[model samples]
Target: MFCFHRLGLRAAAALIVGLGIATSARAEFPDRPIQFVSPYAAGGANDFLTRLMAQHMGDELKTTIVVDNRAGANGVVGASFVAKAQPDGYTVLMGNSATHGTNPTLYPDVTYDPVKDFAPIGMVGSVPIVLAVNAKLNVRTVAELIAYGKANPSKLSYGSSGIGGTGHLAGEAFNAAAGLDMVHVPYKGDAPAAADAMGGQVSMAFVGVASAASMLQSGKIRILAVASPKRSSSLPDVPTLEEAGFKGLYFAQWYALFTRAGTPAATIEKLNGALKLALARSDVKKAMASQGADAAYTTPAALNTFYRSEVKRFGEIIHRLNIKATN
Candidate 1:
């Protein structure tokens, strides 16, 4: 195992003491306005979740929680901002697996070290993506879709959120495991990708729950299979990809809270509390449920462990796929 030098240990202790001082310095954590940054478009799923959590967190922290949209470079822009921000408690990042886990493998020159540069605050929850078919496809289950793809081969195409986003990786992972080659059609975002699927421009898509939930409910698109280990609570009737024949083929994207690596420990603890409480609220749970999202919570340590595993897993996949990072 690797070990830290003497000076490094002292620095860690000072950081902890500093956090304690910061806590005592203020009556509470949110004595000032808090800024939460989302590394995606203003209206995407990441932005939506950050907004929802901020509203509830505002109530608990007894201060305004401002959400800033810094969309670009597949969430790299906002994440880089957060990585370089002051280690103080005021600035926080809602980091997804795309930036934290997969980017390292995809980008040959990763800007931020996922496990080193940021402190793991807490996990928001998990979102299971679905393999959805347009109403025109006439394919409804995973079995039928596989058979049709095999017969037609490259004739069928599917859309993804972006080239290296979690939604995109899910589709690629499916294709790799199933040994089938379907033309991959990339889009700017999940909304547009879902739009193409609904418009019959694409035969099917592997998209996040947020973009496809309403369409699925209204019968706009037929869900072939949910890419999760278990059936989603919101769509329990929909079989998992494993149940549909591709056993152990599960892909879900989740978000975690973070701050610069040198952030105050007390502030981190305070933020973790707020996250747990916000996720517990009936309103957040209901909102997530409507979006086919589950309200799961985890402690800071657990979140860190999870983050490490995800980083390792996605690192392997991205390297194999030869995805090159832009920045």
Candidate 2:
């Protein structure tokens, strides 16, 4: 009986040791390097924000976060890749308005549901869209641009980063509001669209402020109005579409962090905490401002709600405008 009692105690001790090891393994989330996916090319605003957040969040998480650029299909390729990634919190997506707000509706065969396939981590920031015309056009204000478009329908065309991006939607909303017939030209990215706008290839380009910032300095591109509720701090002198006589029209190129759905709630919380820490840093905010983005953060739940609403709102706009993806 004494020997049996000792054996039973040893068995219990072994079980306790095994359980403790399992618990430790579970707690060591992100023991390996995490992959941060940017769904755009390098040197762009999206990539810049991705690297910036990765640097700060990685420090807070005590791990190396590698940025992987998977640019294609107006953010479809990278978004789909992250959507299908393992739900282990190691693979995260720097998704934006195109990925979460409009792509699902634009691409008929989009592989993932924005709301269902991803767990919201938090919001990063937003860059306001702007209506910028070539300086050669001599258009100085939104009203003048609209009048010119109406007077010369053949001469009025607008370029956007892609077919279904916020820039495209903003341009279309402007067309509907001002009764203009500007042709829509879709570029592979914002730089090309803004470049063409400055080069006189298009009458105007509906692009993010960052894409047009340097060109504005060169005196080649003139921003007519911001496609947001208020003037962006980066362009304080510009007025919003509402203030320009087009009320209730607002658009911004927003970005956020998301991981594949079904990731453990604790892991999501850890990522959110690190993201909040990164966004709170003054350097991060200043860097974002320089890129024409306002540094912002939201709780995971709040982001989830905002994301859903964006999806719905963009869907209505796409449907109304009859916007379709060319490829």
By lDDT, the best candidate is 2
Off by over 4 Å in 1: 1-28, 217-220, 324-327
Tens-place lDDT per residue, model 2, 153-225, is: 7678999988898999999988988888889999977889999999999988999998888688889999988
Computed on alpha carbons, the lDDT of every model, listed in order, comes to: 0.82, 0.92
lDDT of 1 at 205: 82
Residue 260 of model 2: what lDDT? Answer: 99
Of the candidates shown, which would achieve the greatest TM-score relative to the real structure?
2
Model 1: which residue pairs collide? 107-325
Q: Candidate 2: minimum summed lDDT over ten consecutive residues — where?
A: 146-155
Q: Estimate the Cα RMSD of every predicted model relative to the unseen true structure.
A: 9.5, 1.7
For candidate 1, the C-alpha RMSD (Å) to the true structure equals 9.5
